[model samples]
Target: MREQASYLRIADDLRRRIAGQKWASGEQLPSRAALAREFGVSGAIIRRAQEALITDGVLEGRAGSGTYVAEQRKRCRMVRFQATGQAGAGYRGPDLGVLGEGETWEGRSDVMTPAPAEIAARLGVDEGAYCVRTAYEHLVDDKPVYLTTSWEPYDVTKGSLVVLPDGGPLAGAGVVRRMAELGISVTRTQERSEPGTTNAEEANLLGVQRGTPCTRIERTFYSDDGRAVETADIIVPSVLCEIVYELPVSRS
Candidate 1:
């Protein structure tokens, strides 16, 4: 038990070190023999530490080149919304307090524009229909976490909204919540987050280099009547967020 505990501690410590930039992404971790010497343990202990990091998506061990820090990608943990009988009931509005002061809505100066042909087709709108576009950058601890743009039919939102107050309508809250009051409920949410690179504009906003690893999230929201109402393109920094999922095993 003591040996296992020590190995876990070593793995956790190494994880923090990588996250802290002591060992940058794509860089190799110390050799098992070296790490074993550093931790005053056997090579097997160091091997166990590497295994833990691999399981956690922090490091990858190549066949011969050694263990390298994995590209920073946030892992998603599964969070199942309980069937509290509220799945179909209208979603409650999240208080502005829940969004906090960390992220603010900096107003946009540009007018809303129509989406590309592909997007227009998906939204069941004509390519020429006026769409209100709102852009936002969410910051955490003064660092940008996501750069996003949301589009809605101009005929729907009345007009483009900018600079909503903290916790105010459209503040901190995702588009799904904002439209709930308008009788627009999200009957379905499709999210596909994958490894991607930052574009020139996104890199400028995120203070990162173009082509930096990022997670692109595109979500389309639908009204209760099953009509698509809004679409959002969210760009998340790979280093900061993680996705988590849990599975229930059946016992027969």
Candidate 2:
């Protein structure tokens, strides 16, 4: 068997100390150099240990300030009802809360954005095709919790009442109802979710450590003819919410 890395050993010890109340929640930790000297390990090892803890939500980094214990966060349960004709049958409920309660969001739309390769492929459109992209910031008590960016092929709803997702007579009515306004019937929804680390943009927008852990959800809405009408990326910070999917059994 191979020996464990020095950083993992250090990380384990750090967890023990935190568990034992050596470092209380929201309290800053000693400097990397100081910890390295005390542990008789290299600064790089200490840095790695702290980074691992940060990713696990056990600790957090402050820009130019240093590392600190993460505060206890009440992770909201973001539920996705997979069964048809059920209540809250959407990726995100009206509000982020478990029962669709207190939460607000801000949305902005860009109608002239060109679809990148991946997005174009998802929308079944050519690369550089014009698309309406909308970005949303979901917040609780004015504190940002998550984000959603949506892209729909321009040709699908151009020159219609639903051109701008956040605009139009049916504004904020949701994709299904909006498409229904355009005489388009949306039949199915697909999603794929994975764990990932936050990038610089996400970190800055979410007000978290640069390397904080997050859940990335790729979602697409399709019509009866099997055409993808819209696709979106949902970014949920790990410390803010827990995603739950309720899948009903098929009685076929």
Candidate 3:
């Protein structure tokens, strides 16, 4: 509707263009001033549209340069691992819940980034080494619900489908899922969840005001021999997920 907010209108128009393939991967987008005139809105409104595209991974803007269309791919999908109750089947096929579309899993090159001291200690790896990092962000109805970063030894993950260069269903499926397939079944799961404030990137993606309160869920998965295989930092907006627990009481 014309009465809609200017930012929303600009975003809607750009969405249509991207969906229609008007811009291809690596294609440059019009300058802000140009877009403003096209939409009959101010540059501020144009900036809003660009921000939305960047968050959605449809476009990437380079500082001092121009914006370019990002490669199109299935960025996000439903990954449901049932913890208990009727949902206890585990993260199988899609259709777990409405994890509104976007990059559910993002694969990056096999580059080494120095792990935080805590992460290095947990993984038992040197601070600097070839590590394959895969990042994942999940959304429910187009808003960020979960964010995770996973690291695997380069020798273990190289030549594997860790990074979706061609952009297909997220390989690794998730560390646990892939590990189980490779005969490395997880025997124990440790989780430490607490409340915290959302960071700048998460705040923008989740559509929450910056520094909004959020829940931080840290999980470390181990094999039977006490080998730590994977570590994940899961940032979850409480509004989208609820944690329920069941405790058995001792009989008197």
Candidate 4:
């Protein structure tokens, strides 16, 4: 069996303490040395514990200031598949119940881009094969909510008006319809999601702490003929949005 680390044990205790109102939201925590003495551990261990909390969004660390309890936030629900129901638009905005139809997104697509090893594998293309790469930032009232980077194999859409995921006759038109215009019917999509931490660039884009908790989704669209037409990586900040998948239920 895998064992929990020393700092993780302390972090659990700290979480309990916060739940009991040991420090109110936005309230600074004790110094590292003080917490170390209280826990009978070294200062370094205390620092690790606090850092873990910060990464989990329970604590905030200021450059010169000490750690503090993070303020509680009401995260909005983001439902998948709802975006596909939208009509006329090439790019489908998210289905945030709170944001409603007010959400706006902008994207830039680059043609003939070389696919990285990871993305190429998802698209079933060789490394460095040409593909169309597009990046999107979804927002509500100008506040960034989430980000997506998509890759589509060039050979699939080449010579077609839908080559550019965001810049064709069906611009903003999602992958399924765009491929349909090229006689390629998208049959299904597969997604794998897991918890992650925001890096420096993602932190800046989402306006959150460097190590803030996030949801990372690796999604791919498949054609009826068993070909991967497009793949994307989506990043959602945990503090601002909650990821919920609404699977279809058969009433029969």
Candidate 5:
């Protein structure tokens, strides 16, 4: 059998040390040169080993500071909407926290003069169609936890009282109630979730490292008559939040 690479072997040794509590959480690790000398390896090999640990979330690097063991992340559980749950059945605008405490949400809305093609497709409208877009940041104690962008076709909302999702009389009212005011009953929702890596923009928005694991959810709401009314894309940092889906089962 081919032997494992030197850097990988060193990384495995470090992992065992960490698991054995030789280094406590949030404790700083030895410098690369120091570790290299102790391990009888080149500095480059030590650096690679450390990088592996960083990617595993066992270590974190701070600018101008040495590497340190990462602290256990505080995880928030987010409960998804159930078809039978009254609290989450409709478009309540930006209700972020389902079971987490000390969480707050802020939203900003704008009218997209020309909506993007993908968003237009989700809303069942033509490209360049006017749409109302809202961006939201969910935070825990002022730290970003997740981000989302919601789009609604302007054709369904123009000249209506619910033009702005977070404005006018229906401000903060979820999509279902606002649409009901316009005689549109939202009866169904569809959601798709996938894993992804954070890009620079998302990393900055969520205050996480670039390339961190994340969850992306695409959601759409449909009216009773099968008209798509609204769509949203939500990005969540994996380390900070856990997405939980509570599915309902029917018995015959």
Candidate 6:
């Protein structure tokens, strides 16, 4: 066990070195044999340390190439339900905090799709019910940061200009504003978040390795009548973002 402990210590030291900028982003790391010699450890120990860094997203390996320092990932802040007074072209803009500035979002909306069972349950609608779904990818400096999928019951939005989230005069006006146009007032929202691992699709979208740690959030918007106006799933890489929730305190 002592030998195992030594490799972990070596890994921690290597991480510190990387954080200290001993090797710049995209710069190839020293060979395993070299690292082993420098650390007075076996090549296996050096390999294990490098593998740990690769999994943590601090380093990346290229086919037919050596491992290199990964590009610095921006730490985006995802604020839940905190209106930013910001409007985008095709979706309700999020309270991205510091990341809001200079950030660009691209999205696609599809109407009259059958709602999946999980989405139906969240919206309190029958399984296979038609709904409008929109998928969004948020980017910073032209790099994908996060992805979101939102669903709204078709019965409520059918035949309305706002049925397509990215269409009509109120395009991207947000759920609250769009619902208000139909005399529905969104009074509250609920969100649940948990840790998750990236799948192949998510990995490709976010430019991270499969099994990378990520944050999964489920959010639902409720009207004054307690009807679910919209529900969405948000996926963000844990290494690149943090989720913050601010709750109001009641004064009796």
> Which numbered prediction scores highest in TM-score against the true structure?
6
Candidate 5 — number of clashing residue pairs?
3
Name the runs in model 3 displaced over 4 angstroms.
1-90, 93-111, 159-172, 245-252
Angstrom error of the Cα, residue 128, model 6: value is 1.1
* Model 4 spans > 4 angstroms off: 1-74, 82-91, 94-99
lDDT of 4 by residue, 1-252 (tens): 112377888999999999999899999999999999998888888888887787676898878989989877556666665335443334354222223455777888898999999998899999999998988887766667788899989999899887877685777667877888988888878889899988989876775778778989898888889999889898899887887655567799
Provide the TM-score for each candidate, comma-separated.
Answer: 0.52, 0.68, 0.54, 0.67, 0.69, 0.70
Q: Per-residue CA lDDT of candidate 2, range 47-135, in tens?
A: 98998888676898889999999887566766666633344454333222242456667788999799999999999999999999999
From the highest lDDT down, the ranking of the candidates is 2, 5, 6, 4, 1, 3
CA lDDT of each prediction against the hidden true structure:
0.63, 0.81, 0.61, 0.79, 0.80, 0.80
For candidate 6, write residues 1-252 as lDDT tens digits: 977887899989989998998999889998888999999999998888887787777888777888899887778776543543233343355323235565777779888889999999999999999999999888877888888898999999888877877678877667877888888888878878899988878877887877978988898889888999899998888876776755457698
**For model 4, what is the alpha-carbon lDDT of residue 134?**
89
Off by over 4 Å in 2: 1-72, 83-99
Tell how far residue 95 is off in model 4, in angstroms: 10
lDDT of 3 by residue, 132-174 (tens): 5556656544545566666655554455553322133444345
Candidate 4 least-lDDT 10 residues: 90-99
Model 3: per-residue Cα lDDT at residue 174: 53
CA deviation > 4 Å runs, candidate 1: 1-111, 159-173, 245-252
What number of backbone clashes does candidate 4 have, counting pairs of residues 3 or more apart or in separate chains? 4
- On a 0 to 1 TM-score scale, where does candidate 3 land against the true structure? 0.54
- List clash counts for every candidate, in order: 11, 0, 7, 4, 3, 0
Q: Higher-TM-score candidate among 3 and 6?
A: 6
lDDT of 1: 0.63
Weakest 10 consecutive residues of candidate 3 by summed lDDT: 92-101
Clashing pairs in 6: none
After superposition, the stretches of candidate 6 with alpha carbons farther than 4 Å from their true spots are: 1-23, 27-69, 81-98
- Each model's Cα RMSD: 13.0, 5.7, 10.0, 6.9, 5.2, 5.6
By TM-score, how accurate is candidate 5? Answer: 0.69
